[model samples]
Target: MKLPSPVQWIEAQRKRGHELCLMLDTFDHKPVLQTLLKDRTHDRYSSLYSQTPIAELAGIGPFLIMLDSGDTQPLTELLNSPERHWGWLVSIAAQDFPALVQHWRERILVGQRPDQGIYRFHDNRVLGRALSSMPPEARPAYLGPAHSVCYAQGEHWLSADNRAPGQHPLPEQPHWLQVPVPPEQRARIRETNAHRFLLAHHQVAYLQLAEHRDPFDWLRLQRGRAEGWGWHAPRQLEFLLVSSLSTPEFEIPMQWHPRVYEEPSEHFERVCQEAKLLQGKGIA
Candidate 1:
């Protein structure tokens, strides 16, 4: 069968209807998350989440935690400094993760306060919030959607603010991540972290001021040709394929096969032209 467009394939999946999300293991005790959050000192932090040995186990994928160390250092500085320009928020998708299957939720509800500033990634704003809200353990004090995923088994919430009312929620988890924090700063930390983490990991660099972290921002950006952004099709494809594969719609192939010959014959040349694409056609 001829393959449909990638977007079409995704749409088809959605149309196919319900997806199953079975609860895998809901650790009442979040050993991994706790370990990672430990000593979240700005000095030792790296923007790239993939670098962590355990990041992917929580469904964040390789680049999800990816942050520019230098850029991030500034954010650390922001947190450590007296007056910070940015504000912070953070969240995790593990709580909504489904082991088996479930219907994909398309709607996203982003909540923001009038005064909250949009701080992109590892910035002073977020660290300041973390510092203000999280307790000595560097964990969120109250049980949030983000924290809930770590605490229990069946579907529940780990992290998420009141803003995202019901835009097709990411299911639920069992337990909650309990942080020792004041009620006022909790929302700030969760919201700010969400923006920065998505900017670092997801394909798209420009955010829409929404609270949701879109994993496919890169693909949409490339297809839409976002301004002030230079991206080669190869790099764009790499990002999209990798991100999509993480929360895969289809199973991934086990092996890679390189072409035996360096150059492409007449057939290849014709195919390239017919496809109306030019960059990576050295084979032809």
Candidate 2:
């Protein structure tokens, strides 16, 4: 099935009297946006980080910017084009920016009380998967105010529409509730993270590994091996996975493995060097 491109989708939304906006994850192009928005101060944009406890980091945080459907070229051109931006499109029936900002602020922190953590729902990669995994009843809180949310996955654009219609109320304080992430969702998130890591740090190895086995299955298998080795920390598991990518059967020398009290940085470097040496000689 053919999926509509971003511009096509935006045009359709505009015709429906829906307000077009973007929830940008600016981690990669903070400077580019900073410069672009300076000349276009009339365009409404709210940094999710501003006025929050972490206000100092506002410059690098995600932004909720209203998109001028007729004129998106300026913002899109800053980083070469719209295709390079990392965010999802939001279509809202009501154009209340303050309400929209509060809606997202409430979602910034997730998980149960006392153990709450930052939720990167702004990232299109994470948003698409997270929304799919959520139950029908649980979606309203996340989809508040927005009539529909759309994101791109590979060459296809995927979206979720607000089925309930009415706006979900925002709390007086930014709410931090436990958003249920099922076991399969957890595995999917882990798989995505691992694949992103491999692509960034071990592109050739990731390509070779993908040709043999699916990245998710390989990650699950590698994760099991890491757990079997009693390595539970994220850093330790990542080190094991990266090593396995270059040298499929590589194992951390028992003596070189970090102890419970030690950090994995030193051990990661040692194991990675050993893996590289073995890969060079075809001995791993």
Candidate 3:
């Protein structure tokens, strides 16, 4: 599919009631570039990654560039400039931008477990045999027969501490075990693994850059770790572009696993509470 220009895409989303903002690097002047270079040298860092060149851009306000039909030069310049580095042209809704940043910051503060709850779907016989062989404590939560279209609903049950079988329950005592993952879940898992791997490798480095800290060393370490795991830098960059953008239609794919389930966003509950408190204060 041919993608719309960034401005056109954002405008269309706004017309649909999505309040969005665009973030891109803008070192349009030599003075700004000189200052950034001086700061970078003073920090005494070597082996800086390509993306690190535009690290300062995250601290400043976003640039709202206008585009015209057949006006591809600016976009091309932004993408191909050797002197200027740009991360993904992230177009996030205004409301979600803060929450998303907070989420990434929290992830950095407390290191994340990328493979926490990944699970592979199996046929009834296979799952049943595995469950029968395992002890009660080791068995997965919410065991029941498989359903045609209940993987998402089943996730709710799996996350809950206490769950019971409903009217049309599966054979197993815990109803959740019977909930079958959709066939497409496998593809989603692979996509999610690729996404998380990229994020896990670069998130801390990105966060450091955002804070205007010296992240060259950190970026080097991450690069080595990623290489050790047999990941290609170019492929990782492609994943980062997609994963970092928070447009209305984008969904962060997830994987299923055997760990205790928690909602991916660590600050979701806190953000909800703060919103409610503000709403209540307004009402009063």
Candidate 4:
């Protein structure tokens, strides 16, 4: 079959939110590339393991999300699985910790602040599991039962009462950037392992960044038209609640985990190579 031209392929992608993956020589293997064929397009959305990149899908179409860490498991299986309601959060086991610690370091030196903490053991039990999909060597040493600041974004240090947060930054951008969501946004993260328990009952929890001196004020200002509330999309706003100043103490804010997809370097290359091959076949 003749592969479509890159320009032609781009057009089709624009029409729908499907993803296009191209491989580069970054990995120690051959490259392959792939994407959606316009003719076969459908409205069905992707699941966690879908080949499509989540960042690409975010605002491009019509769909509801069940966010989960991208496990190699097939999308069909995830959607059909018995624990369908259970999605995934970030886990330390799946992260490159040495890289993460460095990032937090840079952030603090700049005085802008950054934190890197996500996953341990407590969060795993509370949130279902930890390091569900990370490479073994990269997994952090699970210190008994504990909470990761949050595997979301980047992790960070918390306040005395587990209220505020601070992060360290690496001198470099790190590898996760190659994934769907880039790490180290303006705000660093705290593993939300502690927050996972609340998720069973509340789909949207507005826990403070803890690092944010007054996360309360941040939420108020966030609720105002200033930054606007919601996940990914603007105005997809959500509701929030406050917890007491004691343990389990924090405010719930506007946030929900939506399934996201990213093309790992290996997969991206695989698809691109195929695209090129299809192109070759077409020419032959």
Candidate 5:
């Protein structure tokens, strides 16, 4: 089935009372987010904080947590430190933080590869297949191995450093002709493709506004775009404004045209301007 256009999706969401806005380089808005987290007057939503590792939280919920990995400090220290730059603004109904931790714990156990360490979901063989299946124009946008199936699987399979008692060496582990994509991963691949197309073609980004409680559902909706267009999310909206770092030359007037700005402030100003224009035109 053909999916709804990004604008159509945004309009459907707006009707439900959600406000969407786009900002460039979410890192620039760290102070604004910190303020939002401190003020709880907004009855519509509540902020959630967690000390858990982000990797474990991945695929757990619809919430996107942007961290400044540029800081070399430990994550725990970074989370509680007064200097903590970004804050998480989550919906009140979407407070599934504890459940997300539990889900990740379970997933860790299930994804363990006998002698190998944890299986990296992104490196799954199914993802490779999905990438290969995309049209040539869209395929190059996704970085990583897409040609050889074995290479992709090898990337995900983390061999144990030392074998446990009674366990065979990593090289001796049973080899399979094909590794089927888990049902959850399949759904992620599909949704990821949809989001990727939106970013690459429509030049829009989708952020997780509310908490998707189900791990499977949450995994499916993530933008999943690793590179290009400088993809990042602050909080509050599932899909944010579509903007690009480098403006593209387009023959037709795009509903949301990409433009380059000297600074993030300029980019954000342009985003707001464009949003207002679109609203005035009744586009969404």
Candidate 6:
């Protein structure tokens, strides 16, 4: 579905008495950090790592910046661009920025049992998947001070709201929260592995695949298909999946179909070459 323009969206939020803010991920790209610092103002903003043991890493960590009128245009451009993946735009019912910062700072470290680590919850993909996997009642733990959160998903913005009836903001600072790795995030790790592999070794195929479908869903489906075929090696499966992206049909050749354990690179190359020829003829 088409979303209202960012200007319209923000105007509507302001009319509803919500404070606008952005949770930016500098680790994704330096442009996000630069944008935040370039427009540095007296308006409330805090790095999620500030006042923490990793304070030195604040420059590259997640930052929560309350958006002001001057920030609309540049931020809107970034928010609307799908490839930027800067972070999420948030609307909060209250103007207590410190409380919102504290809410997220407490969740910086999360884990399952003895394996606590820096949670990349700031990444919209990770957050989106995590929210979808949780029961409605448990969503507020993540929603915290935000009235609603929106992030770029494919060609549109996806919003997740606190579903509980009353206000459910968490302002207290909790350290080293013991939260399990959401099943969706674990699956995303594998999916990203395949995507990174393609970007590194098969740029052409990566672009083609991205143009064809949502890369996340496509990679997940490819992983499932590979597993079902009993091709259990991670590297080999990645090769199979990425190689298929360059071809028109995106299927393994019949000759390779008989061999369950062998690498399918050779068969894939032949198919990819034929696909290129077809494209050259304007038939692909």
229-255 in candidate 5: lDDT tens per residue? Answer: 232322211223233212232111354
lDDT tens readout by residue for model 6, 1-284: 13555555666678988888888876666665666568476557787887875475676678888877777566866765756667888888665677778777767754443334456667777676666666666767777767777776667666767654233444253221333556675567567646655665677877876786887788888788766665545645765685567468665445445354545555445555765676799854
lDDT of 2 by residue, 125-149 (tens): 6676667666766667767877777
Estimate, for each residue in 42-160, the C-alpha lDDT of model 1 and write its tens digit.
43222232223324323331111212223334333423322323222232243332210121111011123322222222232323333335443322222122221111111211222
Which regions of candidate 4 deviate over 4 angstroms?
Answer: 1-171, 182-226, 229-284
| TM-score, model 3 to reference | 0.23
Q: Which segments of candidate 5 are over 4 A away from where they belong?
A: 1-261
Q: What is the TM-score of each candidate against the true structure?
A: 0.19, 0.57, 0.23, 0.17, 0.23, 0.56
Q: Best by TM-score, which number?
A: 2
Q: What lDDT score is found at residue 29 in candidate 5?
A: 43
> Where is the poorest 10-residue window by lDDT in model 2?
170-179
Q: Which segments of candidate 2 are over 4 A away from where they belong?
A: 41-43, 74-85, 112-114, 135-137, 169-284
TM-score of candidate 1 against the unseen true structure: 0.19
lDDT of 3 by residue, 1-284 (tens): 12323344434544755333222333233333233334233322111112232232233312222222233444445434423333223223334443333322221111123322222221222233334444543332323111110111211211111122112212234333344545455334344434444355556534534465333343444344334434333344233233333222222222211124543232333333544564578721
What's the residue-level lDDT of 117 in candidate 2? 41
Measured on C-alpha atoms, candidate 4 has an lDDT of: 0.26
Q: What lDDT does candidate 5 reach at residue 173?
A: 24
Query: Which scores greater on TM-score, model 1 or model 2?
Result: 2
Worst 10 residues of 3 by lDDT: 145-154
What is the lDDT for 247 in model 6?
60
